[model samples]
Target: MKAAFAPTLEGWYERHRRDLPWRHTRDPYRIWLSEVILQQTRVAQGRPYYERFVEAYPTVTDLALADERELLRLWQGLGYYSRARNLHQTARYITEQLNAEFPATFDGLLSLKGIGVYTAAAVASFAFGERVPVVDGNVYRVLARVFGITEDITTTGAKKTFAKLASELIQPASDPATYNQAIMEFGAIQCTPVSPDCLLCPLQQSCNAYQTGRQQRLPVKAKKEPVRNRYFNYLVLRQNGKLVMRERTARDIWQNLYDFWLVETDEPITALTDLNLPDELAKLVQQGRLTGNPVPLTQLLSHQRIRGQFFLVDLPDTVSMPLPTGFGQYSMDEINQLPKPVLVTTYLNEWLG
Candidate 1:
């Protein structure tokens, strides 16, 4: 199986691989940048960000020296703010500690922030020819189905198992990078998560899932937590062209990002009229702080669905906000410059743009 694996897959890769920007490079930094951007992101969606980042910070040292706010701005709308933060930290560590060179060995690479085993393997194999296997989502699906392994792919144990299996296949290959790239591309294009092109697959005859008619069931996952619903009411305040914006410091979704005055509810409110605004906000309004109404909006995250209502308030010139420290007013220009979550950015563009 290992003897035939490389030639069979690498042949397919040579003919069918997509002409992505990162694929053309042997540079580890460029490959690392693309890998980080591609995690949990579609190729089409992440390609632009890869291009932007490459253009913005041509070198690891350049990224290391950038301000956090500026880095967050570049990473805006790329949902996982933590990845961006980790990327910045890793760049700094590499530039300052390692003389701007990515660690040559997989284990050394893993010591860097945000570079997991999979990422380490990918970079090490592709850039340094380290003869290690790369197991990402695509690889997991392909291997589980091809071999019809039933171990739930979601668990940590499954990861080591799959990585070991993948390594066995790659170790015998003439070039590990070619085989690694082939398998990943094969999984992405052939053994897809949904509605795979089984008929056209070259490995269909040998595929255990196809033989047993269990393609859909082979790559099983442990049941995740139930999808949770959350209600968020944002107070979009404006007084003499100043808008209320707060840096979200809480250890929640969009942490360290900017948002508006928020009120979270346990249950969804069908209408703004049903919601009882906080007493402090109500008292402030009565004391000539502002007058407002709600604008409905909602966004879906992986584990949670958020239904949001924006209460736009216009304050009188004489009143001042009793907002907490770190909650400040911003002009339209300043507001546009701050790093905000995608949901908040959408609202601000519609209401204040």
Candidate 2:
């Protein structure tokens, strides 16, 4: 079973692999960019971003010299901004410390910050032709079902088991890169978590999950923590055709992104009067007139659900009220250029029109 496994997947991959742009190159920089962009993103969604990034920054040095704000703006819609930030930091480190040379081995790549086992193994195998396995979510699913692994995938012991099995499985493959990509693609297209196509699978006969009719049951994983609810009240204070916005500097979600003045509440509130605002903001609100009805929007993150309500206040052009600290007025054009949260962008598009 072990000997036939690698060849079977290789043959399948030759006939089934998609023509992704990254597959045609052996450049570690491009490969790393694609992997990072596609971490929590689908191929269909991340492909354009990858193309834009490659076109913008063809080499590690180009990426290293890129403006952080411009980079974040380009990476706006693709949530998990930390990935982009880390990508930049790593690029800078490679350019400055390592003379723009990517580490050639898996262990060496792993030494870099944010370069984990999966990423290091992928780069080493795909670019350097090293015989190391890449174990991502797709690999986990493929191995768990094919080998009839019933261990809880979220547990530490199960991680070790999968890693051991993955390492052993890659030992016989003639091309470790092809074998790694083959299994991941197989899991993505054939052995999907739900409604896997077992009828035409090459490994159907040898697959324990298929024979035992437990395809969905073999890869046991613990349930995720219940999503916490958060309520955000945004005061869109506009005056003289400009909106008051501020960059989020808190060590929390949406850090470094621009948004309107925000007030978080323990519970949802419909009216602005319900808020126990600061003395200055309260006096200012008394002077300004409320615009159209409050616009409500919701954005869901991995572990939190944020429900936001926006109150547009139109202050007179001659008002002398001092703006809050960290807040400044910006024209619509400037606001459009600033990197903002998706929720804020959605509000602007829907309400401003």
Which pairs clash in model 2? none
lDDT of 2 by residue, 1-353 (tens): 98888899889888988999999999999999998998978899999999999999999999999999999988989999999999999999999999999999999999987789999999999999999999998888888889899999999999999999899999999889999999999988888889899999999999989999999786898779789899999999999989999999999999999998889997999998877789999899999999999999999998889999999999998888598899999999999899999999999999984
Worst lDDT window (10 residues) for model 1? 284-293
Give candidate 1 misplaced runs (Cα > 4 Å). 227-353
Give the TM-score of each candidate: 0.64, 0.65
The C-alpha local distance difference test score for the whole of candidate 2 amounts to 0.92
What's the CA RMSD for each of the models?
A: 17.4, 17.3
**Which ranges in model 2 have alpha carbons more than 4 Å from their true place?**
227-353
Which candidate's TM-score is highest?
A: 2
lDDT tens digits, residues 163-211, model 1? 8898788877888898899999998898898888999988888889999
Q: Give model 1's clash tally.
A: 0
The TM-score of candidate 1 is: 0.64
